[model samples]
Target: MNWIDELTSTLGDSIHCDEACLLAHAGDKWFASHLPDAVLLASTTEQISEAMRIASKYNVPVTARGAGVGYVGGCVPSRGGLVISLAPMTRIIELNPADGIARVEAGCLTADIQDAAAELGWFYPPDPASRKESSIGGNIATNAGGPRCLKYGVTRNYVLGLTVVLADGRIVRCGGRTHKNKQGFDLVGLFCGSEGMLGIITEATLRIIPTPPARAAIQAFFPDFALAAKAVQDILQAGHLPAAMEITDAFTLEAARKHLGADAMPAGMQGHIIVEIDGQERAIKEELPSIMSILQSCGSINAMSATEPEDIERIWQLRREFSASLRATGLTKLNEDIVIPRSALVELVDFCSQLQQTHDIPIACFGHSGDGNIHSNIMIPLDAKGNERRAEAEALVHELFAWVLARGGSITGEHGIGIAKAPWFEGAIGSNAFELHQQIKSALDPLGILNPDKMGL
Candidate 1:
């Protein structure tokens, strides 16, 4: 029997090889696209296990996917095979405030969980920008982070347990609902950022904390990025740890000005910072001024504070527009989420500036400055015929990653080493570490059916 016939007979109605399903699961936000041989609209862990068993038996490659909202082409089925989609499995099994735990299916939306937790006076603080559209399974797969990660940490930190289906169709449960456990190897963590290679995540037990009563935010612009970065150090050194802090450079600000209108960005402002703090009403009310004072001392321009929720969100709305503004400039934006030591924020921007000047390419830098995961965008202008300089842009990306490595930084901070970064994965991790990775991959996925050809494995 053909592979499609076998999958259909074993998996029943859950298997689909229709053009619509194949096209839907083709790729993610990245520019790459490839049609899978079949798409499995998985609705249960049992279904996924059986599907995997069939794939393993047939030696068919498998790629686990969720939401299809990843920035990297993590879900793209590079090799035509079965694409197991978890989107149909959406379910919040349980939310227990007494236990401080949320049990959810893999396909649950990140923002939905956040809203449910907020209603219960609890918080799920991963807050990836794509939370509204990204799935919990994808977040766990990538170990995603966001603006609030500086204080609350990433998706991996909140993941207390997981239900994973191995390549041979064996279902294994790791960790538990408890906030802390050291029973054995951190197997739960092993899969948290595994990028769907080791196994497929079907459900999760996540830790949740009580929500803070009040929060306030401050928006400040500086004469230069150096002063803005310095203010971040000063705020942390002053014993005030804000929940979220973001910084932007001049090029991004210029794009915003041109796109959002010149009045959107103040004149002579080369840097922008947004700092937010959450706690009891009185404490946050008092903390805002202290942060503002530091901003002013750092030579801030048009410093503004927002204590109301709507007002704070308004500031964030504009902050979120940085990416849109860059896109509006009609340049091809290649966003690289790189990380360096917190102290190197200014230096990283300076390096990007040098690259811009040397190659005549515009690079925009902005993001979670408190931690060092800045979204450095290399904007490539289209030629007269409206074709992007993709080759030149890729070479520039190579140079940028090397520079990041030289500075003791990572090529990717939140997005996993998906197909987009596969070329640099082995080199970035070095030979010894790369071998270890291969050993782990071999041990768990002997057939190499799960996420084949990814991360250069």
Candidate 2:
């Protein structure tokens, strides 16, 4: 029987073997034209297991997908494979405010959990920009990091456990709802950023924190990207740790201000920062002065800190929508997630700027500056009728990644190395690590039917 026939007979009409619809699942934002061979929507764990069994039997690549909101083509099935979509399984199984944990189905929206936590005076801090649409499954698969990760950490830090469907259809549970585990392998860590290679995660146990009572924001305008980078360095050196810290240089800041209007920006700013402080009123007062002092010392033209709730929200709104600002500019977009150590922030930004100058391309420099993860992504001119500009832009990006690696940084920070960065894996991690990756992949899915062409393994 054909792959679709087996799925349809086992899963009813919900399982489709249609090439047209399957092809629709091929490329995500990173490669809009890519397509897959088949698509499977599994409503139950058993169905997923069965799909895996069929995929393994046929030696067909199997890829699990979430809401397809990933920025780096993490969900895209580059090779013709069985794409198992988890969107149908979104269900909040339990929320224990007392335990400070939430048990949820993989497909649940990340923000929905946050809203549920907010109602209970708790917080799920690993909120990526696409929180409203991104599934918890995708977040787990990519080990998603967010602006608040500097304070709260990424999905890897919070994901205590998962219910995973193996490549051969066995359902296994890893980790627990507890604080510590001393078992053989750190399965949670291994699966957290597995990029759907190890197995398909069907459920997750999340760690939550108490909601901060008073949150504040501070925006600073700098003369250059280096100044903003230095200010981030200073903030980290200080004893206080803000809940959230972000940096956007003049180019991206103006882009936000331009398309988003005056209200989209701080009252006065070129380079900008949006920070959140969680503590007593006195603590907020104490940190602001130290933060401002450093900003001034770093060549900031002007600075503003919002103590009022309304002002703070307004400031954060600009940052939350910064990624979408590129769409308003009508430029072909490449949201490269490059991260260096905190000490390398200045060097990294300088390298990006120098690279842009040499290439004559424009980039929007912004990211969780405090964490030293910069989104120095460029926008190719959209007006070029031919693919000439696209090819040139693609080559320019490879050059940029080469520099990023030379500076001791990975090609991806929050976003996983989906199809987009798979080819560059050798450059980023070298062949030795790549072989280890292959070994892990082989151990998990012997027939090689999970996210086949993804993550380069």
Top candidate on lDDT is 1
lDDT of candidate 2 at residue 33, scale 0 to 100: 44
lDDT of 1 at 160: 97
Off by over 4 Å in 2: 18-20, 32-34, 260-270, 382-388
Against the true structure, what is each candidate's TM-score? 0.99, 0.93
Give one digit per residue, the lDDT tens place, for model 1 in 1-457.
Answer: 9777888997888999889989999999998989999999999999999888889988999999999988789999999899999999889999999999999999999999999989999999999999999999999999999999999999999999999999999999999999889999999999988999999999999999999999999999999899999999999999999999999999988888888887787876789999999999999978988999999999999899998999999999989898899989888898899999999999999999888888788999999999999999999977678788788788888989999999999999998888999999988989999999999999999988899778999
CA shift of 256, model 2, Å: 3.5
Residue 102 of model 1, lDDT score:
97
Model 1: CA > 4 A from native: none
To one decimal, what is the Cα RMSD in angstroms of model 2 from the true structure? Answer: 2.4
Rate residue 426 of model 2 by lDDT.
71
Instruction: Specify the poorest-scoring 10-residue window by lDDT in model 2.
Output: 382-391
lDDT at 265 for candidate 1? 71
Q: Each model's C-alpha lDDT?
A: 0.93, 0.81
Top candidate when judged by TM-score against the true structure: 1
